[model samples]
Target: MKKFINRIFLLITFTAFAFNINAQIDLDTVKSQKFDTGKMWSFDYPPVEHFKEAYGLETNEEWFEDVRLSALRLPGCTASFVSADGLIMTNHHCARRVLEELSTKEKDLIADGFFAETLEDEIRIPNYYADQLVFIKDVTEEVQAAAETGETADEKAKNKEEKIKELTENLEKETGLRAQVVSLFNGAKFSLYGYKRYDDIRLVFAPEMQIAYFGGDFDNFTYPRYNLDFTLYRAYENGKPVQPEHFFKFTLNGIDPNEPIFTVGNPGSTQRLKTVAQLEYIRDVVYRGYAFVYDTYYNELEKLKTVAPERAEEFEDIRVNIGNAQKVITSIYKGLSDPYLMARKKDFQRKLQEAVWNNPELKEKYGTIWENIEKTQTELRQYGPKIMAYTINRRFTPQYFSIAQKLVDFANELQKPEEERLPDYKGDKLDSTIQSLYPEELDNLIENTKLAVWADFMRMQLGDDDNYIRSLFGNNKGKDAAEYLLKNSIIDDRDKVIELAKEGADAILNSGDPLIVFIKESQEQLKDLREKAEEISNTTEIYDDMLGQVIFKIYGTSIPPDANFTLRISDGKLASFDYNGTKAPLFTTFYGLYDRWYSFNKEYPWSLHEIWTHLPDDFDMSTPLNFISTNDIVGGNSGSAIINKNKEVVGLAFDGNMDSIVGNFIYMPHNNRCVAVDVRAIVHSIDKVYKAKRIADELKAGKIVD
Candidate 1:
């Protein structure tokens, strides 16, 4: 009777499996959305028709030019001219490093905040500059023609580089501005951008880090935020603030729910154009390994803070950065793990493949591209672990190993003739190279901790039986191995390293130092792997360009190119979304800020500064602090100015919600949102909390107010 029941169940399971296999869905039936690639519309190819259809706004070239002129690109973030007298607005986090540098023994600007009462009071920041896009010209045909002259992938890549250099230099000479050849859609299109750089940037106003980064790591990337993440700066020229023709006026009337909004800024890189095979490699190997590295370093740094109390602040900063990276990596890994999202990506890839294979010209030119990419990814998977293990990542590997590697390279380079030496070791670059090779200070404890973490990662990835792992750690591992290596390695001492380097290549190579020996033994293998990877990359890039061409041919400018940190305009609406089984509001208020503070017992990250602890009677608790918009954004979109159709500043783009992390590969407008500091909150904070009436009055007047 038992055997009979088992037979019946096996029969039923087999029948169900057969039926499911027979009913599999066809690739042809899978549909792709228009905005699946996102609305990161390039300035070179603005989505005029789409804008008209979506917002009923007839935007022209003049309007785009004005919008472009108003925007500014910082070192790694974005900003905009908010007032006529060069009053620039950006996120507080973006200016944190500058604030630290500006602080003196008498004052801690980062802790107490800063406000320049008069024009002369603004502090000039050295080696800091902001770039305004002054001119743009399409140079696609010229670049493609140059690339076509090459007969091989390597030759094509070289020719393309040379052509871009030539075009950039020419543009710089013509416009008398910093010029760059911006590649769009993976080299399908190229545009020359000339930037009018403002070198004399000064800090005008900044909020305390406590408020700027309120809620801290726990609340980063989460929506319904109440943080006042904003700062003001002034761009000076010839000892005075220049009156810019184009700038966004700070609107007193705040944003409304579902209102059309635009974000114009330099969004960094995105991988929406990458092949499915490449994305799979990133999902399974690249990001996974990176996530592990970030997690390990972050945890180790946290532990280090307890032991190294004097450097607690420094360690905390590093930990915060690592925590942020870990979050992004894990989020991307999660997104890639989603079956539905992966299916959508597959459907989009299939659509592209069908479009190509349907045409004889495209099929002959790009048929093997996907298959070749898959083959490359397979090869990369084999080498990926080894590369990850040996790579001299600053965050993971000890500085002594890096210094040793540099010393070895220096000795080798010195052996070569002047003409045969690499650029870094020749002429004007030699002094800088030597100076960098011998640093003034070395943090022994931090470096050893990093080494221990790295040893553990290597053991995990490469296994205990692996040759290098076995040699480095016979029976011991982790902390023991790290200590042994540091104890035996003479490179840890700057004087010893300099002397060894001075003795020439033979002495450095035969040093028998544990770190040096390991580097030397793995040098040949690392070099070979790097060469092979570069070759594969060159081939992949050539095919990528071809794929880009086909994509452009099929969709034209309707599908905006993948972001490359060049200025772009993305359109969306101020909106709310569902999260954690509850609806997030379109805007959050100061009342919610206090709620979080009190809810957490006013402890740490959520704690308010002294000034913010007791608010004035006039300070409106109902004032909106932060808001959400469906606008597409990424890492580099921080400090982007969110603007309305009238070109008024509505908010400052500082972050993206958790859902937006997947924006790296695809944009889902339904849930993904840009988190921004409300412009009204900035005005109110300046007027009531900081009591900077001069800056507040200028922001209101859109000019310098006495």
Candidate 2:
């Protein structure tokens, strides 16, 4: 009897695993992958042309011209061309590197607005662009065939990679654009993007970071915003301001409250098509775990900040990271916690699965995909976190990673003979690049951030190593890195953190230090683990497809991905949303600012800097605040064009009402609204506060049209 019971238990376990592999989420049938010819836009309706037609009164053109020149997709950013001359528009957060380059202690361009009146005034960025998408193709069938080659997975992958390069390179030459092929579902579907590259992009204008990032970390997603986070960048060709044939001229007309608007730009990514089961897995496993881990870190960082208020900058820095991390973690958890959402998703998935299983056409479209997904998920669980952690802990540290990168590049060049080396390699270009490495003002910021990280690492890896840590940093055992930072006792006998910045090319090929060794060793580990990763990646891809398949089968293609720096047209009203039992206002005034200021007792980002104080008394009456009529938005939607029903530029989307935090993963339109800065408010602030009426008048003439 006991043997029988044991055998039954084993049988049940085996059956469960088999069922898990076969279980298909039914949510992947909403969107048709086919891109319809003749339609330049992807929204459910034709809002773009209608919007352009609305402007027909101003421009006597027969056809409503296309405002979107091109849309380009990057890993984290979605870029779109607004002007035929290739003026690129994306989120302010998307162009963070450019702003960072322009920042300084005496005049932080981020804190103080930067405006360029002429070409000479335009700040040159190291690498800047309006990446324009010139071409796109559906390579789904070809990639699917390549991936199914009977060769070993590695050989097959290599062959597929080569095929992708060959196809994209040929396309690039044919189209005279930079072409890239992106794999969608473990090679199930492929997207080919052709980008028109523009090298000369100059900063036209950027608002003060204080107003731009008003409310700071605490008030990031919270609504009723008073932030003016917007920037304008101009693209140049042949040193002249190239005129654009197709650009969305800002219109002065207001929006009809219920009219549909289309956002035409590169949208980042969406998981709206995921299976209920997959979402459940993310909610139960990933987000919850992340929240648990970060909750501790968040509290610890906050405590550390409180203990030493002198390290305010350092504290603020970490606080932002912590807050951003927590927002994501909590958002996912909240989405999962809602039974209605879960039920809706589950129902959607089930409907999709049934649709596929019942009909022969559907079965052919999506079958045998579930087994692959489970396998991939299992594999991904093994190394994804470790790989991600490495990038976070190591590659992100500028002092270490930048030097390592330079070393790698230098060694690559050394491999070639001196005669064959690329020209301009050792000229002003190299000097400029090296100069970028030792940005003096950024050093303190970098040091402070690294110090926080190092402290955390010590706490995690070598818990309570008080004596050892004290010996390493001498004075402030847990706080400062002054003693141990390069100049002190030997961690690599390296002093002057700036020295690491200087050793660009030699560190990788020449260094024998443990850090270098560790990096090399990790690369070896990655190489060894490639097969496992590929298998996981492939499965995840399959699962994602299946998830999409299931969702599409249920909900259709109306829903878009979470804001991933991609352009999406969310359809929520401009009204206030309720949080807890209280209603959040449609717009926040200067009173809220004062309330927060007194609340924090005039804190650092919240504390209005000197230039802000002398403003005319009338300016205190909410000059920078505005509301929008768009649907829910998230972090990636910052700097989004918030157009009116007339398709005119009314406001710029920046934040979401805090009451709508759940909108990060799910669009709860009844309670969510995209927060935007009124364009008029921005113009008013510039005219009144900055005393830049000349720039304002020019902007008024061309910035917005009736």
- Indicate the TM-score of model 2: 0.69
Task: Find the candidate with the highest lDDT and give its number.
Answer: 1
Candidate 1 residue 572 C-alpha distance from true site, Å: 1.1
Could you tell me the lDDT of residue 521 within candidate 1? 70
TM-score of each: 0.88, 0.69
What tens-digit string does per-residue lDDT give for candidate 2 at 531-596? 576765654654564555454454343333333342335433456556765876655556676676
* 215 Cα displacement, candidate 1 (Å): 1.3
Residue-level lDDT tens digits of model 1 in 296-376: 778888888789788887988787777778889889988988766777788888988999899998899888878988988
lDDT (C-alpha, whole model) for all candidates:
0.87, 0.54
lDDT of 2 at 325: 62
Runs off by more than 4 Å, candidate 1: 1-31, 303-315, 382-384, 403-445, 459-465, 474-514
The root-mean-square deviation over C-alpha atoms between each candidate and the true structure, in angstroms, is 6.4, 11.9
